[model samples]
Target: MNLRRILAGGTATIFATTALVACSSSDSEDGEGPIRIGTTDASKSAWTVFEEQAEARDIDLEVVNFGDYSTPNQALSQDELDVNLFQHLKFLAEYNVGSDDDLTPVGASEIVPLALFWKDKDSLDGIEGESIALPNDPSNQGRAINVLVQAGLITLKTPGLITPTPADIDEEASKVSIIPVDAAQTTVAYGEGTPAIINNSFLDRAGIDPNTAVFEDDPESEEAEPYINVFVTKAEDAEDPRVAELVELWHSEEVQNAVATDSAGTSVPVERNAAELQEILDRLEEAERNA
Candidate 1:
């Protein structure tokens, strides 16, 4: 992770102009293949911006959309994709630790909030002793706890830790009991009348409106760095010139604007250099191992 903001004035306009020119004038450059990118529907529009921007650099950026979260990284690990742009640093670090993969981030993307969703209930005030459903995975469980603490439904004896467990819950002060289930199960888990903390990635499948979220994290805060999504590639390609250009274009006004509008203003764009990001990843991975 050696990311830096590609700060050049009028870069977005240049990218747009170059992309339009290349797309209309050329098919493929000598010794260059399409730069395949894998991501979810949430960021598809944002990638479209990157794809177009890549054209200006004579790189044919192809987007491979995945319906399930599990397959994108698997494909990337197997060389099925040149890069992937969906997972946050925590999820990616957890995946790398578990799979022994060396996939790494090259650019900071967006930070989507972990929201509390409930059907037939307007707010947390109406709920009580509810058997709340949340992610069972170590990385996200702690995030859910932080959201609960913010909502005043529970308290952590030691607050602000990136990874917290139910054992960390102050039960006597907790307004609701937690039912930890698999990450995908959280969507259906909410249907059973128990409010659940849902990751933004699964909101479409869960059919919940993000704006209606009863609680959310502060996307601009330092606490949100661990959750920022990123443009990632295998460790070996981290500094490939083409990858560098793609990452630079990602921070361009066009792509950043797409991220804001396409996510319906839910995901917040944040910038972090590689060294700073790696520091966060190291801490998260250590916590995952201990958990």
Candidate 2:
């Protein structure tokens, strides 16, 4: 895959155009060819579930792996993939604004909570002026700030919201020096020195023990609502019959059990009302536009 085009520009322009072109071209050749799924390279358990579910459905499922958070949504918007299952509504909304992509979420997936890990300290208060690494992606960076605020280590002017940037920090109560790093490198940042707020998948990839972390986002908290990962497709095809079928399959007893067992509580299935889900997505999109 061409990584350069995938990584170019703001989320609205580059990704949206790519998604539009890809989807338009693919739609002409074969609408029912296969269910092409896009996802990040970080989550192993989700990949397993995708494979198992596809096999059971006897449907051809192609998994396109992306190195960064931006590409998957771009590919999905362009119809390069039938669906993508890697990002939360917050990230999706940011991409929509940054790229002007009209993507829509069809299914709710796991919640891989953001966690703050320290190589030197066991408590948040012990770390003063320590360099803290965060995901460079807008959504996760905001999440890291929220995690810090939750730990009482910092204060965000807008708490319990998505895509909050460094500029959003109140500064009065915020002390730690925040460092933005690539999502994949945040785990390594922790090992290099200073504490880092690593996403769940990266932490797992780096073999970091979650118990050693001084703080973690509360999975059940209201702050986590925007971060609930989803399976998304283009807005036009959002309510397609196949899309509903696929979502039902994912929420099935067998699949849910598999996800729960495989992720070991890291990926939980959320029961959300349809209107409520749309409201959350709308709020995120509004936030992204206003940002």
lDDT of 1 at 263: 67
RMSD for each model, in Å, please? 9.3, 5.9
Taking the tens digit of each residue's C-alpha lDDT, what string does model 2 give over 117-145?
A: 88867877768777688998866787788
Candidate 1 per-residue lDDT over residues 1-291, each given as its tens digit: 111111111334344334323332122122155666666663457766666666666665666655566667876675656777878888988898899887888888778888888877667787668888999987788888877877788878887777678999989888888999998888897777678888776887767778887778787765667788888888877776766677778889988898877666797777787667777888878877886
Where does candidate 1 stray beyond 4 Å?
1-32, 40-43, 65-80, 118-131, 181-194, 205-207
Q: Residue pairs in steric clash, candidate 2?
A: 11-98, 11-99, 12-98, 12-99, 12-100, 13-99, 19-77, 19-78, 23-78
**Which regions of candidate 2 fall more than 4 Å away from where they truly are?**
1-33, 41-45, 59-75, 120-131, 158-161, 175-189, 253-265
For model 2, what is the error of residue 124's alpha carbon versus the real structure, in angstroms, after optimal superposition?
A: 4.0
Error of 1 at 79 (Å): 4.8
